[model samples]
Target: MALDFYTNPMSRGQIVRWMLEESGLPYEEKIVAYGPEMKGENYRQINPMGKVPAIVHEGRIVTECAAICVYLAEMAQEADLAPHPDERADYYRWIFFAAGPVEAAVTTRAMGFSPQPDQEVMAGFGNYDLTMSVLEGALSGRDYLCGARFTAADVYVGSQVDWGLTFGTIPSRPAFDTYAARLRDRPAYKRAKARDQALIEAQNQAQGPQN
Candidate 1:
């Protein structure tokens, strides 16, 4: 069976959609609207978390945007989006870094919470500044998260940086600006953005104008 992609255009699913486009693979997308539809039993079967982005491939299910990106890249090895086995350490490292620490730090700040110094030790991200500094250091002189060449890690990390900068969740830094610029130049990224924009516009039109 072809891959089944469950997503909401306005959600983080846009990241996975970009990854799918980068993979050059055919997928059947099921748009699950933001509220009741996403929490419905049918969609819940694919992801108990009732998330916006989930994928069913070859009878197996994958959730989480980062994981989905890695899965698709590895599956479509011909696309050269995944690193070779020997070079995969950085690939896995930064991907999980974005999903874990970076995500936690940004989310906590977005929600208006900051851990105390004593609490930093207990927090997976340490603190927002520390997390951002680590990420900035990683990308400081690098073209991609794994180094010179682009990989699946960039898709996940780049999406985070792109979204972070756009929403002011992450402070804008030189490294982030340069990184996002590179990601925007990719044809696949452009295609994904255009596709999702159309979906967003259509949905808005359906909902009609608000006061």
Candidate 2:
């Protein structure tokens, strides 16, 4: 049976789509429009959070971006995209690290939300500059997050770097540029990205201009 991927081209859903391609797993793609209707009855059954990038595999529902990515990596063990048993610690470390603070900083910048001086302690991401600096430090000397070879961590982290570069949310430092370029050169990444870009253009055309 094929995996079922629920996604939206314009959102974080694109990351999971890329993972599906890299996993070499056949998935049936279902596009969900962004609106309250998606959050209504239907999507809630898949994810109570009404989020995209969820998947249904073998009658089990998996939501959350990183969860789904890790799940798929495990399911396609032959791909060997995930870290080995010994590397598991570092794998989960950077994976969640990217999902947590890195994502927080990126989204906060995208939304134009800044933590005031008094709220800095309470702010999960601290500040964008700090977040980027930390990430650069992590990726500086390592070709991949786990060292020389690419792992599933690259899929997740590379997605962030790719999106950051595209949206100008993350600075294009030498390390980031090299890493994202490497990921982009992958055939699977190219295919998935092209499909999403086409879908986005189609959606825009359909919407046209509204007064």
Candidate 3:
């Protein structure tokens, strides 16, 4: 069966779309619109969470942006987007780091919530400053998350950096600016951006302008 990608261009699905392009594999995209279309029974059957950015590959279903990126990279082993078993420590570390701490920190800050010092222990990200500081240190002098080679880890983490900077959810530091610039230079990233942009424009036109 061809890979089935469920997504909406306005959502986090763009991250997975970029990864699919990087994998160089063919996939059939099912554009699940926002609101009731995504929350309906058909889509919910594929993802109980009623989320976009799920993938069906060979009868198996995978969800979450980071998970989908990692899954596709492993499926395309020859593409060299994933590290060998021996070098996967950094791969797993940074991938989950982006998915976990980075995501939590950005969302929390964007929503105007800050954890109190006493509540830090109860928070997974501790605090936004600490989370961003650690990430900045990790990418400061590195070309990619796993050093010289750009692996699937970079795709997931790089998307976080790119989006974070673009929306001001994360601070604009020198390391982040440099890293996001490198990610944008990728052909896969560019292709995904163009495709998603077209989709967004069409969706907006269909809805017509606001009053």
Candidate 4:
């Protein structure tokens, strides 16, 4: 089965890129720029959401960063990126935790809005402060989410911590710094970053100096 990766170098596609690299899957990369190209009928057929970071594998369309990471992990059995049988509980818990609460909290915070005390009950993350605390506690003493073992959950959850620290959306902490550093040291992460960096540089050069 052909693996078709649709992404823009600047988008969350980087997450899927790292997953793909780790999966050791040879995939066709399709760069869909923002605006018309991404929203065009041709690409929309592939993903109705008209977003980057969607993949077509085994003749099925998979969208969203978290789902893509989990799917690749399961498919790439030889790589063992999926959690071991015993770690399944923590694996699903944190993977969706990152994809849900961590993601919601960070995004809402960055947007300059957080749920009030009463509103917190409605917010799935409760509040940024609580979400951050819980996330930190999850990674505090363990080398990985599943107790010293790295899984696809790390790719999803780790990206949240890594980006949060880098972009200042999530507050900085020693635990986050150390966790992001560990993920940065992975060869797959480095490779995905480098490839995206190259593309960004090329795009910049083509556009020339900006005003």
Tens digits of lDDT, candidate 4, 32-86: 9999999999999999988988999979999999999999998999999998889
Error of 4 at 130 (Å): 0.2
Cα lDDT, model 1, residue 63: 95
Clashes of each: 0, 0, 0, 0
Prediction 1 TM-score vs. true: 0.97
lDDT of each: 0.92, 0.88, 0.91, 0.91
Taking all chains together, the TM-score of candidate 3 against the true structure is 0.98
Q: Cα-based RMSD of the predictions, in order? A: 0.9, 1.7, 0.9, 0.9
lDDT of 2: 0.88
Encode model 2's per-residue lDDT on 88-154: one tens digit a residue.
8878988998999998888887898878878767887788888899999888987888888778888
Worst 10 residues of 2 by lDDT: 117-126
Candidate 1 vs candidate 3, lDDT winner: 1
Give lDDT: candidate 4, residue 137: 95
- Give TM per candidate: 0.97, 0.93, 0.98, 0.98
Which candidate ranks first by lDDT, i.e. highest?
Answer: 1
lDDT digits (tens) for residues 1-211 of candidate 1: 4799999899999999999999988999999997788888988999989888999998999999988998898899889998887768989989999999999999999999989999998997899999999999989988997788989899999999999999999888999999999999999999999999999999999999899
Off by over 4 Å in 3: none
List model 3 lDDT by residue over 43-143, tens digit each: 99999999989999989999999989988998997788988777699899989999898999888888889899999888978999999999999898889
Give candidate 1 regions above 4 Å deviation: none
Report the number of backbone clashes for model 3: 0
Clashing pairs in 1: none
C-alpha root-mean-square deviation, candidate 3: 0.9
Q: Candidate 1's C-alpha lDDT?
A: 0.92
